[model samples]
Target: MTVRPTDRLDETVGIDTSRPHPARMYDWYLGGKDNYPVDAEMGRQMLALDPRVPVMARVNRAFAHRATRWLTEHGVRQFLDIGTGIPTEPNLHQVAQAVAPDARVVYCDNDPVVPARAAALLRGTPQGATEYLLADVREPDVIIEGARQVLDLTRPVALSLVALLHLVPDEDGAHELVDGLLSQLPTGSYLMMTHATADFTPEESTAAVERLTAAGSTVALRSRTGFARFFAGLDLVEPGVAVVDRWHPELGEPVPGRDDGTIPGYGAVGRKP
Candidate 1:
């Protein structure tokens, strides 16, 4: 693993490397070196269950890219990306700003490790503005407030919850939180999301969920119906809610093995009409 420069994060922040965090494990899956042994161990177990787990992560990320590109092309100049994960190359802002140089983006993640390397995230074009917020999605008020600093809440902003909702169970009021955040935005704002699901591989997905919950990470993989409910009252884009690979594949390259194996996820883009 290549040793990338750490961002020399704030010392007061709390980061527990003792247990595996979803962000770190996700980084590990993406062939990044930011994760610890605990994260790799859990990721290995997940891979053992389904060797295509890494492919699923990549597919979900690709969905985010295509959705961001579509939103930018559709004239969305502001973005609020929660569960922004580690600072992967060609991030949401990269994809958006590539189309609109002045795009403003707010990236939020619960992981301190991500902020530890947020400098890479801040390296956007001078015409654009990018900021990282260390907050949890369960608290939408805090996220919305922090996002307002960089993004104009009155404008049409794309609220991206890509590969995030599974971490927040229904008991945690995930639907209510999304509604609250959307309530703060204006009409024509978009909601772009990709979620893990058990509809394809029920038995394996359930086992993976149990294992993740056992390791202190909640994986509330939703079904097609449950995932669609998040966009209730909003106008779904063409093709409606579909699998990650099926949602606007023309906008981005397809992930290998995404179809050979069940991706176990749903991706969609909706306009707040």
Candidate 2:
């Protein structure tokens, strides 16, 4: 059953479609129809900054898929996927449920568009349970609380924050927010994430960030070192913290255009113990 967020929460929600939202822009990149003209205009500007933008998006999604597969295959049955963009096909739940039919997934995102079409994300295998929570990463308590309704926090759960933290600046305490959430999970839990960075192409990255910021979608591109801090104290998996496209390429098929050139993003998976 698709539970409307407005029904889940007592407060009335408002969606402002006049401005470009990151989730909608990402949908535009993935060739989804849930975006408006504002999203396309901003997406085009990003393309002008770097034509590989779409390729990078595909690579990021590939990494998330591979990581989810890896975790499920390794005995992780519960998932808390924050920053889940639009309802793209083969969503996190679908990938995990394919590997382990009983896998349970909780998808979270602040975007109003996501909740509107969240029914697509909730459809999973008969043996598994899938739920969507209309919440933001910044409010860890709200997310964690909502997730407990569908997930077991006492057991090991893979926390997926792929391609999310870049939109959250340091002033917002991105690091603190991650640590705060992980602090509540069991020792065997994991954190899987990918973040955009300025390390590869400084000039283009800076300009892109400026445009995104001006359009109300702030991008705080991190360096390699900054990205590593998110995993502080956790044991990073083998071949730790490599570039998004380069991490465990043998684990999955190569994205068509991902190898053409460098994609400015960092990806890593860490175990709580």
Candidate 3:
């Protein structure tokens, strides 16, 4: 069965189309029509600085798909995907449930636009369950509490933070928030994540951060070491902390233009022992 957001969610947390949202900007990058003019404007600026922005987005998404498949094949039956953006084809639930029909998934995102199109995220196999929570990652307790409605807190759950933490700067206790969520899961649970980094092109990355900050969005691109810090205390899977597309390329198709230049992102899956 599918669990949905409350009807009052949209009214209470109104979509602020006046400013550009990261999720909408991401959608625009993916060639989706869910973004506004402001989002497109910022996206264009990002493209101008690095035309690989769209390719990076696709590479990040592909990482999520491949990571999901790997987790399911390895016996994971539950997933808690935070920072889920606009519903695109073959969402986390689709990939997981396809591999294991009984897989259960709980997707959480702060974007108001997500709740509007969350139904697209909730569709899953009859043997599985899919749910959406209209909440922010900053409030780990809220996300955990909501997820409890659908997932078993006592069991192992894959905590997915794809393209998310970069938006959460240090002042927000990004690392602390991640630890808080992982602390609630079982020992065998996993942390599957992808973070955009400035390790490859510091100058361009710094400029991109400035543009997003000016537009009311936060972008804290981490270095390779900083990106790996999120997985501290966990055992990283093989080919650990690799460039986005380099991680398990055998599991999915390559993103076009991936080899054209550096993707400037890190992706990995780590198991909590």
Candidate 2 residue runs with Cα over 4 Å from true position: 1-6, 9-11
Which portions of model 3 show Cα errors greater than 4 Å? 6-11
Better of 1 and 2 by lDDT: 2
lDDT of candidates 1 onward, in order: 0.86, 0.88, 0.90
| lDDT (Cα, tens digit) per residue for candidate 1, span 145-190 | 7777777888899999999998888999999999999999999999
lDDT of 2 at 200: 89
Against the true structure, whose lDDT is highest? Answer: 3
lDDT of each residue in 20-138, candidate 2, tens digit only: 99889999998999999999999999999999888888999999999999999999999999999998877898899889989988888897778668754458777788887889999
TM-score to true structure, per model: 0.94, 0.96, 0.97
Better by TM-score, candidate 3 or 1: 3
Q: Write the per-residue lDDT of candidate 3 for residues 137-220, one digit (tens) a residue.
A: 999998999889899989999999999999999998999999999999998999999999998999999999998888889878
User: How high a TM-score does candidate 1 get?
Assistant: 0.94
Candidate order by decreasing lDDT: 3, 2, 1
Please report how far candidate 3 places residue 256 from its true position, in Å.
Answer: 2.6
